[model samples]
Target: MTIGFSSRTSRVARVAVCCSAVCTLAALAVATNPEGAGLPFGTGAQDAKAGQEPPSLYRPGTQARPRAGAPRVPRDVSAVSWLVADAGTGEVLAAHNAHRKLPPASTLKALFALTVLPGLPAGLRHTVERAELAGVGAGSSLVGVKENRTYRVADLWRGVFLSSGNDAVRVLAALNGGWRATAEQMQDKARSLGARDTRVVSPDGYDAPGQVSSAYDLAVFGRAGLRNAEFAAYCSTATAKFPAGGWSYDIQNTNRLLTGAGVDRYPGLIGIKNGYTSKAGNTLIAAAKRGGRTLVVTVMRPRTGGGLAVYEEARSLLDWGFRAAGRVDAVGSLVPPRPAAAPQTGPESPPVLEEKEEVTGPGWPAAGVITGAAGLGAAAVALALRLKSGRLVRD
Candidate 1:
């Protein structure tokens, strides 16, 4: 049998066939490796991967989603996940996709600092060895540490916060034995602090498989870090001397909210951390004080290429949080650290350490933000649609 069709119908048929094929591949891709699919929580099989849940501003059981009474989030805010909480009370005031895990980029550095800062003496100095800098990921950010140059522990912390320096993280991780050890410690610390969605695979927060965190957890890190005078000081420093000598390098805080460089310096803004990678997009955790009330806001994976979008989104959330204070009931509370346990003497059990205190979305994809093969399939469908219709169709 011969199929009869007009020119327009033929073109349409071809387009439809192409779209169908692309979508099938996308579906299959998502089906095969659902976990790697980067879909937001609650949208795909990935969400069911034990311990994951849908993003919601209101705490679980307050309501399924944000009610009209909740603070109004800016329509223009582009992050896939965000949250605001009372820094002092650990109360999560408002959030969107607060529990959805995504790549953290350099923002994970905050956790690194939290895990290792207490162990290293501020005045302790170590010579930067060539091996310490080796194996840093390509295109990673740096504070220009040079081999053979000795740096104070405090200085390295400053680099981590100011320059978002991968080099600084590497050196410090080495001081703790190695990056792997530091990452393990960071993960352990994250669990103890109630950051349920964090998995620290890289000490420097470089993009790595399974290295993920949620907005809620990032805020937890900020709040926990602020308890440490040193963590707070390092993050808040607007500028720091990289090497204290003639070859001194001035590194500025990458957090525009504090610096007011590419964006308006947020009033009452305090130190925290921000991060980005092609995979992670833009992420930020910001803290500010107003009328004795301290609020920490975290935004992750905001739309890329919009200058200052992350800070702007954070500012919006902070404003909403302050306005909603005493008005909106908290959906959840950031759990306080586990109390220090007395030393245990057993081959199987290690001694517990004391705790230090500190300060501190969007939508689901239809196929649930499929990543890896699923992401490629989605890309194929999008590309085909764009080519055929000359209009962008985002998944």
Candidate 2:
């Protein structure tokens, strides 16, 4: 007992240093305050604790345990932003630039599906309107939703999950009302899910002027999405038949990790989403289970590798996360949804965050008051670990 107390006191003295880092991260949501970051000011973000926003995520580089027994985070991760988390427990195994917002690409569709799928019944069929397909961005992916063809909601979702179809997303958004309203509802849904970094300018996740999300937010979406049965079925769906003009044909999931279409099929992979654009590079959210443990990994814009790097990086990270589990400490946690409460005000029609400055490194001097939150929010910083800094994707 004497030995244990001595060890504890020394460890506490060391970790007290990083308390400031988590404090900066808590204040990093300056945009979340008055401007609201598409969220109501008091969505409990400031009050959130218990590693709700893990401190090391702001390290601007790789984060891992320094102790001898702790599994190291993969050195070659190379993505601009990445995160590996326990889907079952919401413990973030590790992260890099976890909340540094960037364009999300089609991975945003997971949130779209999560937001809209619950309300629309699978058996409900709607005829495709020309207007619904009209606004799909040029060169956006398509699951071939043809105009005037009646499609069951299930079919549209199959198109979305299998093909990453912007056309299908537009149609689904229209059925939810219109693209704009669906975007609002998506924003509301994101805030409710504690995904503050996401700004859903297009339900399809096209690279609009201000459209962006972070690897951390994507992991949150993936973890929450798996909890919903329909979302899980759609994402895990490898292939499905779609109706054409008078016939039907098959479509395959673009998430190569799930289907192994062109990339190596990751064993025990769960279907999530993948996306790319000239602007976003490559982005993915992948989940897999092994030994009864499921891990979710999100990679946004790996800048250092081949075209399939997103899946490869996700696979590698998932591998590391499993290896690092319990060996390395959780840097943070996936915060649960804020309890429903009346907003201080109504939804602002426009996205509130359009910050010009980016937090490319740690301690970039952000705004907001972080009291009682910066220190060990979810779990204490790993006592045996020492952080090392490194510098670093797309989609």
Candidate 3:
């Protein structure tokens, strides 16, 4: 005797079964390798020592790992290391091999700007001497500022951001009392910002033997640089005139995200920086604002055989970050500076918010989700399960 229900009932049963199967597989997958399930931040064993792995933002005794219900993390990004973070809160939303050190190219200029912009008066004008222009690396991008021409600090900044000008960096570094001092200051600033992986051997971010930075550090620089009005203005300026003896040259921003004239132009795109060299591949630190939220994305060493893959990858991470903003838990937070010690002889001061570092294991599993593209496949399975569960209940 055939024991079959009506067609509608049969269809519902099939869907319910399919959904259950999908959900079971997804659950099994997550159980077997929770680290590989596309959760943004780490929810793994903590190492005793700091710096072993990227720290987690989720506090102890909380649900620190990414859940199956979390938004599907993007997996098509091709950078060797990348990170996306909430610009205001310093929360690291997603990362892939974020601490892996590599050549930063011109993206390090953001750090240069952060370190030096605070010291130079915006209106300070200095005549460019031949000596100031010397030692610019061969084939470095330039803004064509001729020697013996006076440029305001603001204009030199424009040259720096608009053209990724190594010459501008040199000029500014000289003004700051030579490249060595500037480099030392930049490295100090990086350390203060919790960017431990950065070592600034060149003020202009040239390909030096030990000039290295990580995606995490670049994001740190981007966030810090954007806090300065002048830095923000310089990076956002799409075009400006650079004065030379009698003729002025119009320089345009090298960051295509802000200009909207490239392979992709993002709305609310602001100033940051981009870089490429034979050794560094392609690097970008991008920022954008939407609905009162600002996001910074850093991509490094993206496969660059063709079109603006760096920009495209940056845009993708930005889109994903916006979509995932409030949906996923922060895997980590950018460590804030330690509060200044109170003066020993001063009046009682307000309590300062103490910063703590959350440690993760040597094999930080959260990286597995961010770095491995296969996490999205598990997300697909989880989605199928959710759909099936809903349909079954309706039936």
lDDT of 1 at 184: 86
Give model 3's clash tally: 1
CA lDDT of 22 in candidate 1? 70
Query: Candidate 3 at 333: error in angstroms?
Result: 1.1
- Residue range with the least summed lDDT across 10 consecutive positions in model 2: 386-395
Q: List all candidate RMSDs to the true structure.
A: 18.7, 17.1, 18.1
Candidate number of the best TM-score: 2
lDDT of 3 by residue, 1-395 (tens): 75546566556556656655665555455546644444446434332223333454212211223556666667778778888899999888888877778999999999999999988998999998999898999999998877888899988888899999999899999999899999999999998888888999988888999889988899999998888888888888889898886778788888888887666689999969999888898899999999999999999987643548888889888998898888877777666556556545446753333344211222323334233434555555555555545553544
Q: Cα lDDT of all candidates, in order? A: 0.78, 0.81, 0.78
Error of 3 at 357 (Å): 24
lDDT of 2 at 207: 88
**C-alpha TM-score for every candidate:** 0.69, 0.73, 0.71
Q: lDDT by residue for model 1 over 1-395, one digit each (tens)? A: 86465565457557666666676666556555545456554554433342333333424322223456766556667788888889999987767777788999998998998899888998998998999999899999988888898899988888889999898888999999798888889999998886878998988889999999999899999998888898988888898777855678678999999999988999998879999898999899999999999999899988754757898889988887787787776666676545656666888864333343110111233234333435555565555545555474447
- Ten residues in sequence with the least summed lDDT for candidate 3: 56-65
- C-alpha positional error of residue 331 in candidate 1 after TM-score superposition, expressed in Å: 0.8
Off by over 4 Å in 1: 1-71, 336-395
The TM-score that candidate 2 achieves is: 0.73
